[model samples]
Target: MDFTPGPQGQFPGAEAAPRSAPPNFIPEAPQMESRTFGAPGRPGVPVSPQFGFVRPGQIRRCIHRYTFIWLVNGNSFWFYPTFVGNQFVQGFRWRRNRWEFERINLRRILFFRCF
Candidate 1:
């Protein structure tokens, strides 16, 4: 029995398999991406220069990985900014002699410097 629907677009019957693929199925696998944030921008930019942290829009513009991130818990580290989403910034952190991926919320950043 042909499972594909005809021009009428009516199901053959309930006993046969579904005419369409499962909802979770995809036609093609997602491709891995390699992105370059471009040449290093002006470093030493302050994250919270006055009273607030920089918004995602400003961080998105600086994609270079030289930004110094200081979390709200007094933990500070320097990492390469890879992807900046609406609420979070994703990047690779140097750990154990290897680049480990890390994500941080834009709001949790207390101090940000790009030096």
Candidate 2:
């Protein structure tokens, strides 16, 4: 904004200040579409590691069911779910001869395959 002094060269005297132009936003920020399991996506989007599995459901049905989960941090695990909640899942992870109990955030898992 450009301000011009009035008669006595005082501030806010007579003439109003010029309006500044609106910021140009189109070039500064780019737009992208969210991707599905097999397609390309942004940073936090989960990726499906293998084929033959459909989208996992609300987690309640996973009791005693074997599952493959890929997390946002690029690590994947085979887990057996025991409980399910809106934002988290409690389960046992498969390892060398044992299933260890763990509680995990649903948001951290990129894609979950239930079988």
Candidate 3:
């Protein structure tokens, strides 16, 4: 009873007669239930910790800095760049989760400017 197609594009073991559907073909609308807020069964969980920041208005700004500085596992490190008088200089490098001063000329990198 295998209906595998051959290289000539013809079914090898398919039947010539057509197939018919069932007698009871009743199609009904899908049963959908409305969900209410603060439902116990819902899988919604709090995104951030509630104890840290009080209200939504208290949150100021979110910063995402990505600097491609490879140390051990090829990960970018973030270094704060500040303008000093007429010239810009690299302030500090965030190494070991702490700020460390580094002598880097910010004037050379004219494209990167953070206000």
How much lDDT does each candidate structure score?
0.52, 0.52, 0.29
Q: Model 3, which residues run further than 4 Å from truth?
A: 1-76, 85-88, 107-115
Q: How many residue pairs clash in each candidate?
A: 5, 1, 1
- Give the per-residue lDDT digits (tens) of candidate 2, residues 1-115: 2335456763231222213221222121112235343422333333333421222355556666676666657677677776565556766776554666577777666656566
Give the range of the ten consecutive residues with the poorest summed lDDT in model 1. 21-30
Q: Using alpha carbons, what is the TM-score of model 2?
A: 0.51
Which stretches of model 1 miss by more than 4 angstroms?
1-51
- For all predicted structures, in order, the TM-scores are 0.51, 0.51, 0.25
Q: What is the number of residue pairs that collide in model 3?
A: 1
Cα lDDT, model 3, residue 24: 22
In model 2, what lDDT does residue 10 have? Answer: 36
Error of 1 at 18 (Å): 47
C-alpha positional error of residue 20 in candidate 3 after TM-score superposition, expressed in Å = 72
